[model samples]
Target chain A: MRAAGGDGHPGPVIELNGLTKRHGGKVAVDDVSFTASPGRVTGFLGPNGAGKSSTLRVLLGLDVPDAGTALVGGRPYRKLRNPLRTVGSLLDGGGAHGSRSGRAHLTWLAVSNGIPRSRVEEVLDLVGLADVAGRRVSTYSLGTGRRLGLAAALLGDPEVLVLDEPVNGLDPEGIRWIRRFLRAYAAEGRTVLLSSHLMGETAGTADDLVVIDAGRVVARGTVPEVVGGHASLEDAFFALTEERGR
Target chain B: MSAVAAEWRKLLSLPSALVAIGLTLVAMPALGTSTARRLAAQLDAGGDGVLGTVTTLTVGFELVPFAVLGPVVLGVVIIGSEYTRGSKDSGGGRQITTSLTAVPGRGRLLLAKAVVLAGVSAALAVVVIPATIWLAQTALGEHGHTWDALGPRVAGAVVYWMLMPLIALAVTVVTRSGIVPMVFFVVNSSFVSVTHLLTRVTPLAAYLPDMAGTRMFTAQGPVHGGLVMLAWTAGLLAVAALVFTRRDA
Candidate 1:
């Protein structure tokens, strides 16, 4: 899936073109293309087995691609001058050092990228983690861990944000906060690409959508455009997958 | 400055790094005192080595902790913790590579890790060295033997300890686990007893990392034997660095 909103280049801020990845004999993500642009929240929609994480991994340069390319700002993510500043990403909350304090985790990231230490404080406050930032991550709840992950991504004040299942285990309040936060993030001329299995949570927040099924792009367009003739986002998604399977 | 600072922060913050250093500090003095007394007793009986009984004991037990999983475990943890956080492919190596991709000079991070590991290992050795010397002298009753005479060999011992961690870190980077390399280190590297025996039959045993590294503890040496050991340590570390830079992290 591609993130939209390139800086007037007519190209996307994030792009995946004919991307194909296979693990041994089994194909994980087949040839697919999508773009996420700035000024919008582009939801990367797919079912349980739909290569959502795999595609994200490829875009983040975590997984090697057998075919095609994954790019940010018209260049590969790995080719960026300062990746943390150009693009912010939160892949897995489990990535944090459990024994290290949340503040330390962000501090290392900041220092690694030449960002100021104070940015760590700003992000911690932004994520509502300033109070408990000194505590070890091993003590954090799943929700709190996700927030710390978010803080890390925002440390660079990046131009583009990529989040995978950001609200997977958030409470209702947390979920609402993320929805508003992401929309406001994109509204400030930044790009946001989010992945989720829940169709409802995404329907309200996403302006554009890319639906994938079994490693293929089943549909892609504005929210209304994709669901134009369907009853709801779920109905539209089901219809698209059903038609693709047929 | 930032790259070094970041690497240093990572080393200091890691719990295992602290534990490893703590253990080395506590163990060295205890080991030195016990061995000093043990050696004095053995010498009084029939120990026959020109370098003295203290030297013999030091050579005999210097590599034990690493052989038993101390340094090897620390090495594996440095790389393995990244894998435990997520997919091994995207953990520490990927994170570093991604950072390097942005900077376009990936070698610095590798250098940074090596520098930090080597720095901490050496600092720990410095602390242990004096304590070991003091305890050994006290337990042996002032024989007027100075550590200054053992300077070259002591330097080599500290370097050997530092190099072991780097080699282990490289193995963990490629393998992405704390267990596999530790098992390899134990089953393969520490099978030195068998190699020691093989030396009587085969000349090739002299070049192995285990045999060659042991020569670093020699009390006073300007011989070809110590140089051969230095070469072995250099060889292993070079191979690790080459593999680390070329592979897809």
Candidate 2:
């Protein structure tokens, strides 16, 4: 429903420069740096416990980085005049209240951000939830909930998308839909930073790949370059993570 | 302004806010009239309107517990619902995450919440008190009315209504749950004034928010009740603001 770069703001260049985050005595994302630029899908691949979630949280300004900056569009997320309009994000299961209808939840976000109600309806329709938008979110299935989260991220028609494990629980059809969606979104010259453990999905959907293990980015290159001499992306991913485990 | 509207809408979304408000508006007048009528004979004969028929008739009925509890409940709900965890094992903690992402500025978000809370509490008092005064006067012989005492008392009711919720809201902001504030304050208002009992041992207890707030209406206090309420409200808010701004969402 959104025109390509509809707001005319160039898709943001997301940068995590020497980013380091620690929880108590343990470090989560340690001195990691990367860039996700416009007009391409940058897949952040990492195994669980590899700190992909923490990095994404920092990137979205959900968690404060202990020692570095996570910048979008040349500024920290909190400094952006309208962050949601610049970067659409999906965090975990999304933060919809159980008591609120899907429409009400989106309505409040729209109100908070000054987005029109018509936009909320359009996002609902975009996510295939317009018919059930009146139902309390407590009734939605897991996949529907994810779609609702995606709808919120898109509410502002942002130039950049930062999503965490977006296809974690989707049906195969839903996963394929998301893959197609991300590809098309990046093709429209908007930045897409997606993290997933599913190598197959990332290999098929992403143009560039950054793989992390144990809170560190160990490899970065195009799909074929990372997969060099390996039969498939999956084999390369395991070999890389296994080599890092040593 | 948008944040304020959003906060108000968020408060309205909760069934608790609407139920608490509706019940208080209807219940206070009904209870005030019935109680005033029941004590009419003793109230009239007992020293010929000694404590002022209006005060004696309605103070016990409309002044504490029920009168203030609903507003107090709503105050807690405004912030408490955000801390409520959802069914998907998604904790209430994420709400702060979502809100911060939406608003970003910690100080602005908290300010919006405070303004909305005050506005809603004041609005509730406006709807409820005039009707309550009318019902009480009708039961006490319908001899027209006296604005002399009511001028201050209604002002006091407005202060009381606004203060109770603000107090509850500040605590909810700290504890991140309405349950504690709702239970403690509702009980403190209705059953036993913990602050009142503590006052016997230490008059300092009288300076606690509720007791000081009661002074607005009763004009009895160990200190200037309004100022005490102001100090406590301002102090609690300061602490909440500090924590909210410093902590990672």
Candidate 3:
């Protein structure tokens, strides 16, 4: 049931223009630019240390880009009022404190954005973590913690979803569940931008693809367009990245 | 206001924060009682010198400085918990990412946390100061002072307790980890007060935050001491806000 935000209104747009970030003397993201539009699952693919996390971090206002802009609905994340209600993001273990119960973790997040506490239970049930929501997150398995993180991301029922490595830790069922959930979510006219190194999964689930290597976008287009002349998306990924490497 | 409410909920939900409060509640009074009992025994033996001159009010006031350890821990944990990493199996993530995304505005997030820290520490002081005073007074028996006699000193202790946590908050923010500030503050509060020792080496040490803060309750110039400690807190928090807002999370 795509009841939440399924009114056919286009969700907020995520745009990064000439974005550059540096850590110490090294560049993490270099002149990166792309758009993740409503009604699309844009799979942000990259090798490890390819600046996917850095770009997402800047977009979420967790980091300051040395130059350029990362914006949601034409405003910087830091400038958005009640950002969570507009953009729900999952970055690194869902940003949860280990000592807190999953419900408590989501409760504070909801309270921060003035979201009704009832939504906490709804998201918990939606993510299938209702029975163990009261358990400390430290006790959760890797896959369970990922679900908890996903639960938090959906807590605010935002217009845009930004997730880094959303399926890093999940069983086969979980993988299938998220694949279906994200498709339904985007079908409701919401934006989804997820970063992962999983090429096969990206090929199967994502409508659009943006690939980065060494802090630069090497390719961008629909899944089939980027996979041009290649046997598969995985083959296309290696071809593009290896060529850049040389 | 919603941000503040979120911070309050966050601090309360942390098991470590709760444990710190519980331990402070039980430990502060116990420590006060034992100290008061020892001082009373020393006086009963007809001891001459500083021991003989110690009044019940003095006994109660002496315990106030040590009461700071609780607030220090509370402040440290409030911010420290944000930086604590989950297990490796859990993607080794920290809560700071979630916090930043929810609040977005760095200044607003830091302000919310400071407000919650101040509120909790002040509330803790209200419960703790009186409990410690009452227990210490009881242990002093015939020489015990009434609550009325300790009025302003109790107020000073509350302010002192409140400010100490803010100082801890600023330091923890700058350090971004609980280890350094936790070790330094806990050691200085309990075992050997490096700040206290520095006072003997140089009079300027009296102007230090902890020493000057203790003067709020123990010395003759309560207002002066409170102001000095407030200045230190304000200065450090300014630096913390700058560092926090300008840095990458």
Candidate 4:
């Protein structure tokens, strides 16, 4: 079994302790625990319905956990003085209203969180959406939508970022842009927790890996550490799941 | 400033806001012109009691444009837009609990929504009142009515239109849909008509958001008067605030 212990590192940027979530009587996430720290992109790897979304939702406080606590900067999300500034998140590309222009949508969110209106334009440029920033979101392609989501996430200049399936519909150019942006964002001493079902997309992107299956943590370690005995990140992920018979 | 700013953006950004305002501007003039024409035709027929008929017709006609559709639709948009836009939790389905985990103080966010709705209501009043009044006066003159008698009627319509949107704003927040508030406004208006039909019931129907707001179109005394209608506006808003806090959104 993969080692079940902390990395002997400083306090993690995000800490989950025995986190569990249940919908009705079905357990979506079993007792799970892991830590995401600063200065690296910690990829939260899981297959569809593997509790990745649930875990992120729990982390962001979108859903309450049946047990355990999800913390950010050593405190719960709702208690933060300015949440958008502390932990920027991109949960779903289609979360925004289609009728609203990209800038209008972001501007409202910015205003709500006390972020300056000018930052709306800034993030749009950062995500390469400046050209179509005034276009209504309904006309955007999936890649454009992803860019808009990323722009909103960056609007706060947050200390920590939690992204779910961020690169799902991105083009090669957009993908390359995100890879570089995420790395640079982390290099600046910020915490980045990204979730993706595709191992290939994250293979070259993530420094640390946390693999989950059947709503449980199957493996957690740096990519090299976990892939020590495997050929690739995919192989390591499958080996862990097969070993657990899940 | 924060509240006003937040509310203003929300009201303006909403698709329903435009529809609501459009309905008011278009419907008022159409109805006003039609009433004026109908009255002028009656006077041309040299009907007895034409002056009294013209005076009463203008006030009664205001209901179709302002009292009924105006207030009900505005109420629905104010609160329903949030739900229609799927803005219940932070970032739409991000889960407010999660949002709370991130920002805490979920209450403040909701309060901001309320502030936006309130400001929009006032702005709607400031803009629509004068325009509606001018239209009503010009239309009545075309119907063989002098401007002197139509002035108070036009002013009343303006006041009623202004107050109606606020009430609708509150109703929508509480009900979370335009359909429910629209149904309530329409049903209540029908009830007022029913009361009048059942007994010498004062035109109390005019005092409900739709009925009473008609008085603004023409200074006819609604059943419960302006105080009662103002109470309705305040009460609906209060309920909206309460529902906003209690609900999951």
Best by DockQ: 3
lDDT of 4: 0.69
- The i-RMS of every model, in angstroms, reads 5.2, 2.3, 0.7, 5.6
Clashes of 3: 0
lDDT of 4 at B71: 43
Per-residue lDDT of model 3, residues B94-166, tens digit only: 9999998889788899999999999989999999888888888888788787767777888989999999999
Q: lDDT per residue, candidate 4, B1-249, as tens digits?
A: 443464466567767667867776576556655666566566568754777634633533444443445545655665565555433222343222322333345456555555555455545654555454455555545444455865566555545555666776676766656677677566655454542343345554444555455555556574345566778877876776676555533
Mind giving the per-residue lDDT tens digits that candidate 2 earns over A7-31? 2335448887989989888998988
Expressed as tens digits, the lDDT of each residue in B1-249 for candidate 1 is 666777777667878767866776677678777867776666666645635433643532454334324455566666666555533322221234333332334466667766777777667766676567667766765332566655666666665666667667777777756678766766655455555676788888866555665566664342454566556545666676676556544
* Cα lDDT tens digits for candidate 2, B1-249: 988887888788877788998888888888877766665655667744555535553443355445788888888888888777766533222456667778888888889989998998898888787677767766766433466755566677677888788878888988987788888988888888788899899978877787787777665542378788889999998998988777766
Q: What is the lDDT of residue B50 in candidate 2?
A: 52
The CA root-mean-square deviation of candidate 3, after full C-alpha superposition on the true structure, stands at 3.9
Q: Write the per-residue lDDT of candidate 1 for residues A125-239, one digit (tens) a residue.
A: 9989999999987778778878887887888999999998888767899999999999999989888999988999999999889888998888888888778688999999998
- The value of fnat for model 3 is 0.94
lDDT of 4 by residue, A19-49 (tens): 9999789898999898888888899998999
* Stretches > 4 Å off in candidate 1: A1-11, B41-72, B85-108, B183-202, B219-249
Number of clashing residue pairs in every model? 12, 0, 0, 22
TM-scores for the candidates:
0.86, 0.92, 0.95, 0.79
Regions of candidate 4 where Cα sits further than 4 Å from its true position:
A4-11, B1-4, B40-61, B64-75, B78-105, B130-249
lDDT of 1: 0.72
Q: Which docking category, incorrect, acceptable, medium or high, applies to candidate 4?
A: incorrect
